[model samples]
Target: MTRRRPPVTPDQIIAHRRAHVISQAAKVGVSAACRAAGVSRTAYYRWVKAAARYGSAALVPKRRRPPVMPTAMSAQEVSAILAVAVAHPTLGARQLLRHLAKHDVHRSASGVQKVLVRHQLGRRAQRLAALASLTAADTGQLTDAAMAGPFGFCQAASVAGQNVSMDTFYVGKLKGVGTIWQFTAVDVATRWAIVALIVGDKTAAGAARFLDHVRAEFGRLGVPVTGVLTDNGPEFVGRDFTSHLGDLGIAHHRIPPRSPNHNAVCERFQGTLLHEFYRPFFYRARIDRIADLQTGLAAAITDYNHHRPNNGAYMAGRTPRQLLNEKRPAQSAA
Candidate 1:
C-alpha cells in the first residue's frame, strides 16, 4: 500500500512555509515553499493576492454577516395594529388596511396582513370576546350558575323557593280565530311545567285562568312556588296580573325588556313542544281539537319531565324527575 498523507493543519502549514521562506531565503521562493509544504502554488499565489489586497488578516477566515433586517415598523405602530386585530379578528386584510388608512397608518392591506400573519395576531372576533369575558370577578365570589346560561341559577333553593319562568306560544288555528294562546309556567328548580290552552284574548281573565291552572298543578305536584317570572307583555305586566300573584302570596319577577335569555328555559321548552308534538299534529289534523291537543301536550310534558335527559350542568345528564327527586327526596323517594 502507498504511504498515507499526514493530516494538514492550517497553523502548521502557515508556520512551515514562513520558516522555509526565512531559512531558505536564497534557495526557495514562495512557489517552492508551497511545493515543499504539499500545498498548491496556485493556492499560495491566491493567499499572496488576498494578503496584498486586505493585509495579513485576510489569511484568517471572516465571520458571517447577520441576515438583512426586514422592513422596520415602530413598536407603537405595531401595537396599534395588534390592537385593531384584537378588536376585529375576523376583519380581512383589506378591511384592516382601510381601517389603518382611516387612522392615517398609510400601509397597504396586504403588507399589514403579512405583518399580522408573521406575528400570529390573526383570529376570529368571537374568540376575542370570549377572552375578554374571562377577566376575574370582583371580590372572591364564585360565578352564579343561573347567570351562566339557560340552567344557570344561584342555588338549588332558588329553584325550590319561587323562581319561575313563563312563556306563551300559539296552538295553531282555533274555531273562528287564527290561533289560540298556550301559556306555560315552569318551576326553574324542578323543571315542572303547567301549560294552558286559552282563547286568542290576552285579557286579565285569561291571565287569572293561567294562574289558577298553575296553582292546581303545583298542588298536584306538591311543590310550593315562591315566584312567577314572565315577559313584559301587556297582559302579564297589567295591575290585574300583579294583584292576582300578590293575592296568592307569590312574587312576580319580570324579565328585562328584549332579553329573551332571561326566560330561556321556558322559551326553549316551548320550541321543543311545538316541534315534537303540536306542529306534527296540527299539520296532520288541519284544525286544532282542544281535547286531542290537550292529550298530546300532557303526554309530551310527561315525556319531557320524566323521561327526557336534561343536558345541563345542574342536572348532569339526569332526567328532570331524577333532579326533582334529588332536590325534594321526600316526594321523589315515594
Candidate 2:
C-alpha cells in the first residue's frame, strides 16, 4: 500500500520558502540570496520591511481578499429580495420589485435581477426549486406538482397516454409546394412524438385528420390516448376538430389564452425538431416535393423516439420508446 502524505497549506509553504530566503540572505548577500531564491529583490526587501515594522507573523503570506463591488447589494437587501422571490416564485422581476418596495427594499427590476443572478436564482425555475426545498424542509414532504417541470403543466400526465399535447408549427414555404405546416403531437408522460407535414394551410379538417393519425398510431402500440391538449387556435377550436375529438371519446383540453407555457411539452418538442432536424436538414437537403419532407420528418421522429436520449421529467435520460415500454404494462393494469 502507498503511504499517505499530510496536506500542506499555502501559508505553510510560503512561510517555509521565506524562512529559507532569510537564512540564505544572512549567509550570502541580498542580491545573491534573491537570485538563489528565484524572487525579485524588491519583493524580498518589501517582505523584510513588513516583518520589521509589524511582527514576524507579517512575513507569512495571507490569502488575497475578494474585491468588493461598489454597486453590489448589501446582505439585508439580498435577503429581502430572496424572501420576496421565494414567497412569489412565479413573479417576474418587475412584479417582484413592487413587492420589495412594500418592504422598504427599494431596487430597480434590473438591479434585483442582477442580485438574483449573483445568487444563482435568476431563472424562475431555480427560484421555484428553492421554494420547493423550503417547503420540503418545513413539511418533510414534497408534492408531485412541486417536483414538476418549470410550468408544472407536464404534470397533468401522470401516466403514459394520459394526455397528449398537439400543436402546429410553420415550416418555411417551399418554392413549388407552397406553404408548409408541421402537425406535432407529443405524449406528455413518455414524450413519444409524431409529426406530419402539410403542404397547404393548417385548417380544422387537417388538424382533425392529424388527430386521427395520432390516435391510430398510438392504438397500434396498444396505448390509448385519454386526453388531447392544445392551444386556443382556430384549428383546434373549430367545429370539425371538436366534433372529431368528441366522436373519438377523447377529452379536449385547451390552454389558457395567450399562455403557451401551459402546452410547453409540445412547444419544446417543436423547438427541438426545428433546431435538431429541420434547420440542418433544410440547410443541406434540397426539397423538391412535400412528400420528401414528410418522409424525412417521419424518419427523424423515429430516431427521436427510439434512439435520442431525452432529459425530461418522465424520461430521466432514457429514450421515449423505452419510457413508453416501461409504463405501458402498468397503464394497462390500471
Candidate 3:
C-alpha cells in the first residue's frame, strides 16, 4: 500500500509556523504547541533550529536523507586519484595505487583497480603501457604522429559527475532505415553507458538531441555533468550541437583529429556493443526489422547496464549499475 503525501505550500507552512509561534508565546508546552500546529515536537524543534540558522526560507521542506557513497574518501580525494589515472594512461592499477601512495593518497591497489574498471580505462592503459616500454631504437624509424597518438594521453574524469565521453558509431545500413547511427555516452568516472539509436542522418540536430538525452539521463541519475568529449565529427562540431551544449552550460572538449584514443572509453564500448548486441541480429529476416532492432537494442542495453557481468579484475561479478550505485557520491555536508 502506498501512503499519500500531504501537499506542502508556503501559505500552509506559514500558517502552521504562526500557530506554533503563537502557542509558544502563550507559554504552552512544547508538545501542546506542536499538536496545535499539526506537527510533532521533534519537527517543531527542527524548524526552530532551522529558523535560528537560516531564516524563514528554512521553512521549506528539507531533504530527509543525505546521499551516500560506499568509500570513506571525499570527492576531492576521488578526483585526485582520477587525475593521476588520466595523466599516466599507461599505468596499471597496482602501479597507480603505488603512485598515489607516493603522494600521500593511501588507497589499496584493489581500490585503484575498481576506479580503473568503473571508468573502462583498461584498453587505453594497455595500449599506452605497451608503448611506454618501447625503446628509442624501436621507434627510431617511426614518425612522431605514427608513434604517439594524436592528443597523446588525456586525463581521466576526476569526479564521477564531472565528465562524459561521447562518440558516434556507424551501424550497418538498414534496408528501410538507411544508415543507422548509435550515439554513445559513457560517464568518465562511472562505466554507466547510454546509447541513442538514430535512423536518419547523424546531423547537428541529431547530436544536439542526443546531448539532451545524455543531460536528462545524467540528471535523473543525480550526476552533475561538466564536460563532453567528442571527436571532430560534423555532427558534434556543428553550430546546433555546440550551441545546445553551450546553452546547457556543458563544456565541449573535442579530441584531436585522427585520435580516437583520446575518447577511448566510448570507442571500446562501440566494439562491445557491436559484438554483444548487433551481431546476433545480422542474419535476421528484413520483415519489420527496425522494430526488432529497436527491441533488441533496448534489451541489450538493459542487460549491459543492470545484468551483464563485468570481468575486469576490479569489477568481477558486478554490473555497471551496481558499481555506480555503490560509488555514487553523497552531497557535501553543509
Candidate 4:
C-alpha cells in the first residue's frame, strides 16, 4: 500500500523552520536539520525564502501561480496617465484623456483611475496635500510650494458661517427640451449643497431668484449661509443679482475674469453632479420632459446631501446631513 505524505500544518512547518534555522546557526547546516525534521532541503529552502519574504505569516500556504493578472491598459498608457494625474490631480479621467488626446495618447477613464489609485495619487490624496499646503500658507509659510494651486487650498469652513458659492450651468442639449440650466449652491465649510432647475433663458432675475431659493433651503436645514460667491458672468454681475444679495444682507463676492479656481468648490460639485447624477440619470432612463429632469435633479441632490460622502477637506469624511447634525448648535446659531 502506498503511504501518503502526512499533511503538514502551518504551525508544524513553522516549528520545523525554527529547528532548521537553529541548526544552520549552530554550523550544523540545513541538511542535517531537514533530515531530523523529516523535511527535504528543497522544502527547507522554500520555507526560508517564504519566511524572509512574508515574515511569520509565510508558513501559511501561498499561491504557486502568478500573483496578479496583467491589466488591459498597457504599461506605457498607465505611465502617461499617472504622470498627467500627478501633474493635474484635480482633473477627472475623462478630462485627463482629452488632454492626452492632443498628444495622441489614449486611455479609458477606469484604467487611468486605476493608475492613480495604485500610486495613491487619487483626487482625495491631492485634496489633502493641497489642504496641507494651504494651512501652511495661512500660518505665514509664504513659500511657492505652500501657495501652489489656484484653489488656494480650499479648506473646510473653520466657522459655520464661512463662504458659500452659487453658480448656474448649462446641463445639456435634450432632444425636445433644448438646453436645461442648473443652479447650484455649495457651502464651502460644511459641503452642504443644493440644486434647482431653471426654466427659460438664464437671466439676472433667475439668478437672484435662485439665490433666494438657496437661502430658504439652507435656512430650513439650519445652515444659514453668510456670504455668497459667484462668477463674473452677466447674470451674476447684473443689478438683479447684486440687489438680491444686498436685500438678504448677504455679502456677495465675484470671481475674477477666467478664474474658476476662486469658485473651485462649486465647480467641483458641478462635475460631481455630471458624473454621479446627470450621466446615469439621463442616459440610462427614459425621460420625455423638462419636469421629469427637474424631479430627477431633486432626487439626485437629496441623495447627495444625505447619503453620499462629501470627501471635502472640511467634511473630513462625513455626509452633509451628518455634519449638520453633529454641529447642530453652530448651524442653529447661523
Residue-wise C-alpha lDDT for candidate 2, range 37-156, written one tens digit per residue: 899989988888887888678878877899988877788999999899989989988999889998899889999998888776788887887777566435534443344433444335
Q: Provide the TM-score for each candidate, comma-separated.
A: 0.52, 0.56, 0.53, 0.53
Clashes of each: 6, 0, 1, 1
Name the regions of candidate 3 deviating beyond 4 angstroms. Answer: 1-155, 284-287, 313-317, 332-334
Pairs that collide, model 1: 145-152, 145-153, 146-152, 146-153, 162-226, 162-227
Compared with the true structure, all predictions reach lDDT values of 0.66, 0.83, 0.71, 0.71
Number of the top-ranking candidate, with lDDT as the measure: 2
TM match of model 3 to true structure: 0.53
**lDDT (tens digit, per residue) of candidate 4 on 103-189:** 567767777677776765567556445545655535523333323333544323444445677888788777776777888888765
Higher-TM-score candidate of 3 and 4: 4
Segments in model 4 whose C-alpha atoms lie over 4 Å from true places: 1-156, 326-334
Distance from true position, residue 247, model 3, in Å?
Answer: 1.2
* Cand. 2 TM to true fold: 0.56
Q: Candidate 2 deviates by what RMSD?
A: 11.4
The best candidate in terms of TM-score: 2
Residue-wise lDDT of candidate 3 within 228-255, one digit each (tens)?
8788999999999999988989877778
